[model samples]
Target: MDPYRRLVRPALFRLDPERTHEAAIALAERVGRRLPRAQIDPALEVTAMGLRFPSPIGLAAGFDKGARAVDAWAAVGFGFAEVGTVTPEPQAGNPRPRMFRLGSDHALINRLGFNNPGSVVVASRLAAARARGRVAIPIGVNVGKSRDTLAERAVHDYAAAVERLWPYADYVVVNVSSPNTPGLRDLQARSALGEILTAVLDVDVRSAEWSGEPRRPVLVKLAPDLSDEQVDAVTELALELELAGVVVSNTTLSRAGLRSPAAMTSEEGGLSGAPLRLRSTELVGRVARRAEGALAVVGVGGVSSARDAWDKLAAGASLVQLYTALVYEGPSLVRRINRELARMMRERGIERVADIRSAG
Candidate 1:
């Protein structure tokens, strides 16, 4: 019997979603050090954006918003972990009762609004962890514009965050796709995105010069609601800017096919989980075809199983991430997915994750 589904999940489901998340993070932080490290199969290892990933499955950004328990995330089986939708300055996010669970639909809707401890605090925590040699896997920091920052200053906001976080990050993500922040998604437009990426790249260059470390790779996270033409434009711009990758997608505003209750489904926020699986996969394939190996694609949206992860890889995703699935499936799902993925690869006579695209 799965203890998480039978015992832990029931108790967790009883609490308010935000509170439950807080408790889970606290517990992981305390127990992380004592947890046994996961033994990942060599066949499941991957190298993307010049960083080695022990497994393709990674804990996506939203779950570890404050950079908490990254080591624990790895201990459980994730190959990498991306933390934050952090801002240059901290702000209290939207009002409470923000996160909603649609158990039947296997989805979650949140308007958390880039609520984080800001770059300074998060950077300090990561620095402390690095000093102790606790971060064993690659840690990517996803940065967003501060809510109060004006549209014109958005580039400055993103650049400031990268300047502060570069030393501690394996890669930095420019999050212009989150629908929670009012004008956030507008930054995804090609001209706007180009300006932001240029400024962010400039920050990376300066940070690398100052720290004597190689420039940290930068990626952009896009929305799942974009038109095919819009997606192509962004992919072309990303290539021109020389970005390391694109995280295909943040969350969506669409409530199109949800099976959850009206009150829950009616919530105004970004939707994720099973409801988003197909569209995000489609976007991943679209972006992959557009990128043509020039930019890596980090497929994330509704991934919950080995088959889901494999599908993303087959669609040309270099890596895969999940958050809502972890909410439903528990930590053990990570190892299970990796184990199944390795078995699938062996069955197909495929040896490398990169070859999944051509296996057919």
Candidate 2:
């Protein structure tokens, strides 16, 4: 008898998917202060990237692309929220009908192409939110190359975003793995990624010196489609660059074993949700194995329940995030997952989330 599943979802699902999402964001913006906050078990608190998260579960990037719902996300019980796949300049993004729902499989396909209100506007919104003291949790900004930027100039594009948005960002994620933007994933090449990250680090150093605040930790969001060697290389590069962590994966291009209609599945976009769970978890474990305690791993992709979150934690993810599942399971899913994670921890006599992989 979950209210969202039986009542809210049916009505929301009737609209086109993107429209439904727009409506959701609009509602969150309006009712954020009035919405009841979800409580987390004290035992679930996590320490990663030198910040304390009230819970280990976070809302992944792409949902709140413009930092519009920063307060709302914390009110809804997320330990932290990562906003944006924001670009240096604004663009309308790919044409309409870009997002599709796969109800049968509890998944989605989208080619939204990082449609956002650019860095300047988004930075303004974040500044406003912070000025009001409405921010309740750490907010990470995820930056992507502008669609019009040439591949050779990608480093400057990402560095510009980090430089512009760093003041408000508790952490930053260099997004080179989203498949929706052309030539985006190609930047994941070791040499190319190294250059981009190095430039971003340089920005971080300057920002810290200028503001007199601690340097914001930086992470890289990678794709789930990389080969084992590619994954290891990126993991090594993260350690070499002294990155705070890696977000182990954006959505995938793979469409294997789907129950959705052929027409829906045939749409050109990255796939997310249940179909991505196993592979994402596997990649997280791979990165963790390679990092060997040197880097934090933020696990994402297809987590719908507490068990799924636990699987990622046990696989070596220090923190976990969700997006597609929220589409299917609704907001209360966050509280339910955290509560269940606490119960599971109690049953196993574990104290903190970061110790999961080691305890296993």
List where candidate 2 sits over 4 angstroms from the true fold.
none
After best superposition, candidate 2 residue 215: deviation in angstroms? 0.5
Candidate 2 residue-wise lDDT, 74-171, digit = tens? 77889999999889887789999999999998999999999999999999999998997878788999999988899999999999999999999999
Give the range of the ten consecutive residues with the poorest summed lDDT in model 2: 31-40
Q: What TM-score fits each model? A: 0.99, 0.98
Please give the CA lDDT of all the candidate structures: 0.92, 0.93
Off by over 4 Å in 1: none
lDDT (10s digit) by residue, model 1, range 1-360? 699999999999999999999988998998997787799999998999999999999999989999878769889899999999889998889999889899999999999998999999999989988997878889999999999999999999999998888899999999999989999999999888999999999999888888889998899999999899999999999999899999998899999987878988999999999889999999999999988999999999899999999989999999999999999999899999999999999999999999998884
